[model samples]
Target: MSASDHPAAIRLRQLSIRLGLGSAAFEAVQNVSLDIEPGQFVCLLGPSGCGKSTLLGALAGHLTPASGQALLDGERVAGPHPERGLVFQHHTLFPWKTVAQNVAFGLKMKGVDAATRQRQAEEFIDLVGLTGFARHYPGQLSGGMQQRVEIARVLINHPRVLLMDEPFGALDALTRLKMQELLLEIRERIRTTVLFVTHDIDEALLLADRVLIMSPRPGRIIEDLPVDLPRPRFAAAGSARFASLKQHCLALLRYDEPATSLPRLTPLGAPPAHQLQFAI
Candidate 1:
């Protein structure tokens, strides 16, 4: 389907999520609303405890909102379904299953014939660069390889909205960068709508079409910034425009001030001394 004709991949309206019950209930997220268009890559960026994952859980139907609604394709998201696939930071692969078996598990559950499931499984295994390791168990693979298996498992089902909560957070720096590149490559091939959660400003900038920053507890979207940089962004990390946008995001998170209130940064090759210490 054309981008315009594709359905709304995700929509939230005044969504509020509370934890606990009765008087013990405390709001985790409040009055947050956003839309993710089909085939778009959107990132939820915030501090460690700012409800980024809470919002993701609500969308995944693992947690229900105390108020308002989480919708997929204009329909209320009452519970988990195959259309919304979730991948977490940790690999949840079954230890006994080989790489191919892990990827084919979903299809098997849906009663796909053995021959078709095997064919589909191999295709995604290769897609994730695990072709030769199809017979290896999850325990035998590296952390990065195991995560790739988890991704292939999810993508094999062809979910309309892929909810990833720090999917690469556990990988080493080099592996994480490779995984990010792999994700972009896969997206080009399948065009699945993605909602990725990260606290790293650089990662958000590099991957998202738009980045939404959330506030502290009772999390709300404090900043919604579009990433207009060109593709293959791996090389643009040090560009002037890239640094400027990074500084803007840092100022918002560090100073908790409006964008206008922040003074314009110097045009020197390096960011100011104060800007250097705002850790991601």
Candidate 2:
């Protein structure tokens, strides 16, 4: 089977999230409210120490809200679910397992029989253009190739909402562009709601249906700008429209900011005490 053809709507109302302990605890996100329609690609754009990941963590069920609602399809997001799949900057693949095994891990967790898991795993592996590398270990692949495996791993579960935390942040410039193209192509077939976090300006403009500009700590949505540029946006750079939106985004990110950068916060309340293992 392919990814869930059914995309889910996301709603947040007056959401406030506090992170850290008594001495250090502060509002990561305060009274934020927004709605993401089914299959819309939205980029959370902001600078360091902003609450982009914090808000995304809440929706993924990794971080709890201090108050207000985080709902998926009108149901509160209490914890992580496969339908709301999250992919991080680094590859979270198993070092010991081959690429196919890593991609199929989610299915294996759900107790699908081995044969069907491998079959579906192959389909998604090919979808991400890693067709013949199924037996290669993550270490055996380049950073971009490993990320492709990570994407295929997440896609194998057919998530309704694809939550990405700067999945290409670590790649080289050329590779990053290719991965961006790959993501747009895959989303065409999956049509899942995507809430991606990024600090890059053009990356947001290139990939999103709308870009949500956020402020520094106690993060709040300051602006919701639509990306009216046409799709297959690779050549959108020369357009007058693209230049205008890029300048606007630059200005918005500079709005109401302190001179010094804030320390970035993870989706977890504080920094993760330990590394997270795959729970899919």
Candidate 3:
């Protein structure tokens, strides 16, 4: 089926996840439910150990929900499927493979012919702005370039849902900003459903169509907010509307903590420094 006809919308019905067994078991995510529309960019923002990643894991079919269910369209997500692609903070590329080879690995395993795999791989490689480096091994590329290869690897498969767990988290500030811009550009071209997990409020405000804030441990969704901002948010970050939204999110995330505990938002239109602290 074409992507338009495919079951792309993701739904979670009272989903909860517990790790371990017996007395040792502890609930990682508790009674959370949310809907992600097809071709939407949704961000999950929370403090560390808040189970945002656990919820994402359940959605990606890497972990089974202890109760309730995660559904794509109407079908239960029982296990990993190619239709649901995942990208994590670290680059999971094959060290021995060239960039082109790494991007084509999935197609190769799916029994696609060599010619088709090479063609598609190159297309995605160029899509992510790595055309000239197709033959370079992962070791030879910068951290940002390696992450681009990882994204290209997943996108070439044409997944219905893309689950990103801080895919740009490990990069330096400048690289992270560029990657975010690249992601927005890519979404315009591919229009895939995306569920991105991040702890940075500004990052969430900048990229998401909607942001869901979760409370600390035994994580539960405390807020479901629409961004309501214009596209090209990188440029809009200094606007009053953007600042208001940022403050709103900050209030929710830091309600219990002291005001001095978290750093203030960067001034309007200022270049964010590499060492700016994120309110986790």
Residue 96 of candidate 1: its Cα lDDT? 97
CA lDDT for candidate 2: 0.88
> Residue 273's C-alpha lDDT in candidate 1?
50
Residues 163-193 of candidate 3: C-alpha lDDT, one tens digit per residue: 9999999999999999999999888888789
Candidate 3: where are CA atoms >4 Å away?
1-7, 256-280
TM-scores of all predicted structures: 0.90, 0.90, 0.89
lDDT of each: 0.86, 0.88, 0.87
In terms of TM-score, the best-performing candidate is 2
**How are the candidates ranked when ordered by TM-score, highest leading?**
2, 1, 3
Give the higher-TM-score candidate: 1 or 2: 2
Flag clash pairs in model 3: none
The candidate 1 region of ten consecutive residues with least summed lDDT is 1-10
Candidate 1: deviation at residue 171, Å?
Answer: 0.8
Report the C-alpha lDDT of model 2 over 110-178, residue by residue, as the tens digit: 999999999998899899998799889999999999999999999888899999999999999999999
Better candidate by lDDT, 1 or 2: 2
lDDT string for model 1 (138-204, tens) is: 9999999999999999988888888999999999999999999998888878777899999999999
